[model samples]
Target: MHDRPAPTPTPRSALPVQARLIVAVGIASALHVGKLPPALPLLAQELGLTLVQGGFLLSMIQFAGMTLGALLGQLADRLGPRRVMMVGLVLLAAGSALGAVAPGAAALLGTRGLEGVGFLMTVLPAPALLRRTVTEPGPLNRALGWWGAYMPIGAATGLLVTPLAYATIGWRLTWAVLAVLAALCAAGVRVYVAPDGPRARDAQAWAALRHGLHTTLSAPGPWLVASAFLMYSGQWLAVVGFLPTLYTEAGWSPARVGWASALVAGVNLTGNIAAGRLLARGVAPRSLLWTGYGAMALGAVGTFTAGAGLAYASALVFSAVGGLIPGTLFALAVRLAPGPQTVSTTVGWVQQWSSLGQFVGPPLVAALAARVGGWQWTWTVNVACCAVGALLAAALHARLAQQVRAPRPGQEGA
Candidate 1:
């Protein structure tokens, strides 16, 4: 007797039409958020922020983004990414305004947190929404590639923009200007994003939360990927957070650090696209993860050394590695669950740890940097973290390989 057939999984290529729309949103928001970090160190000086306080201030947007990102992401499935993103843009604008006019650190922190909330609303649903939009495999791979590109663009460009703003007006004005850009992002969302109505109106928040929790905790691959995100994200964010400060301490101009940080971030764009091309060709996810983490390790070492030329070379290396991790990691996160029932839930769970890493890393690094009284130890810490990340990636790859189907024998064409 013939055996019963297994349920065929949705081909990665057969994603829906909405993916392009979501990718556009990703690019816009990524650029907006990317412009932020570069301005952070500048904001620190202008606002007279202490190291710890600055880290908090820096983390403020991220924390809100993390916390609200998950919440809104769940809502995105119910309320629609278009609507939620619109609301987030409003919040982003409001928060940016608050920070722009901030007279003290307290006010700045408050506003940054608000911006985080806005960012959360706008960016969280991107993966899910995109997944729903595209249909063809080539487009699906390209769309994911775009989604992956957003991070480094957001992170690196934010830093690169700082000095130009600082030299001309100041950090406060920089905030104000970006606030306007955030508002424009809202408009972009409304214009470009189509309302899909509600997805699963019956799905309650708690139900979704429960779903995400169960799927994530139950799956070793998801948890391992989360751990990878935590280690790499924390290390990279903390390292980048300290870059400008490190430069000044190293007796280089703040301008040099800003430029170098930009290079580090820019390198990530290439890494992400490279990962996408590799992923499309049926490369193992773990290979991408390892290469990304390895790049970070090299960059971390580069960040630690003295001398301008060495710093640039190492930073470029670091950024290259950093770029590759997110696309591969996130792609893995989307598939970490066993079935479609848990996709969003598992993705949200992975995000939870991503946020956790982002939330904690900067402050911990700042505290350590304060104790060490320089950025050397900060860079050292990052190198170690990246090394750990590489190891973790290896372990996850091994485990996931067991669960995921290998490329079929004689299978041709991705």
Candidate 2:
């Protein structure tokens, strides 16, 4: 099996100022209005979709992200992260614009799916860019941390801004605004992100991909990590999925759900930043994964029983943790790749699995809720799922540790 090449560790002075700036903008562009789930139903209705259809609309974005991310990463490894990101940003603009003007439901979903592809293009290479541009650990982690916050921030911002857009110009206009944001992000990348070192170009991307996929598939970590995601993402979305309904259950107005979701998303943004900081402080990747999964489970349990204010508070706590897991886990996934060359491909596989999870999460919770009674039963199922996810995390972490600690043939005597 191939092993990930140890990154040529750089000192702090070597951190690329421009690269940091590019990724920061990349973050802003990728998630802008993307994370606002409240707008999903409205977008669906406008496109004449049923609930199941709307769900697929959302699911396909992730589905696209999963497949596209690895493809984009491979392209990044071959052509360059800079070229890939710029192209992605351009697509982001075009996709958003098209989605805004889409005449029918399928057209809108296709455009959004393209946008998801663009999102992956911009995001999947971010860490690769960081590894390439940054040498020092602290600033690298900080940059990655900031990168993580961008999604939740964008999502929360979308939630905050979309309401006004909906009230004023409508969802179409909101998409237009997103297009503008995407265009701006494209411009930033064009001006800022520098080219990779010549060696990165020499990389055998296809071979790396084939090798990475094979190795990652053979490993237990990927399965464990993927399984953990199934539960964590499932429970997390389940909790979020029923929120508006839950709010209504408590006799709250429609506006209450919006505010609650926004607040939860905002707090969730903090978790991304926290993930970077926590990793910088030197926690093992497995530990962070477990913490994230645990938090998701805990939040499900806590809010499952709470009402009104208490429910929102529980929501906030759980979301923050949920936000942290993606980047942290991505980081770990890369580390687990059989070879540095294959990291992107391996990570893509994980993404494909997560996309599968996104599909499973909401319905499973809904089914459980239907079968049993009340939010408590719903949460009980979610909690159980997440707890299993925790176990998966533990197992993955253990397996990954073995990969890191075991010496390669050449280094055995060292």
Worst 10 residues of 1 by lDDT: 1-10
Model 2 gets an lDDT of 0.65
- Residue pairs in steric clash, candidate 2? 2-338, 3-338, 3-339, 4-338, 4-339, 4-340, 5-340, 10-135, 10-136
Q: How do the residues 1-414 of candidate 1 rate in per-residue lDDT, one tens digit apiece? A: 434222223566543334555655556555555555656566566766678877776666677645644445556655565677788778888888887787777877777777777777777667666655654555556667767777777667777876777778976787778778778877866765555553453657567655655544676776787778877777767776667666666687767767877777767778777777777788887778877877777777666765678877787777776777877777776555545445454565566677777788888988987798766666676767777788888887787666546532232232
Candidate 2 lDDT by residue in tens digits, 1-414: 434334444566444666557556655664543443666657655656655564566565566655554555556666667677788788878888888788988887788778777777776667676666665556767666666566566666665566667777887788888788888877876666665544332346566555555665776665665565556555555566456556655776556656776677667767777777788888776777777777776777778777556767778888897777765765565455555555555556665666666656666665566566655776677667766767777777677667658943343332
TM-score of each: 0.84, 0.83
Most lDDT-accurate candidate = 1
Best by TM-score: 1
> What residue runs in model 1 are displaced by over 4 Å at the alpha carbon?
1-21, 31-45, 65-70, 199-209, 251-255, 405-414
TM-score for model 1? 0.84
True-vs-predicted CA distance for residue 310, candidate 2, Å: 1.5
Give the Cα RMSD of candidate 1. 6.1
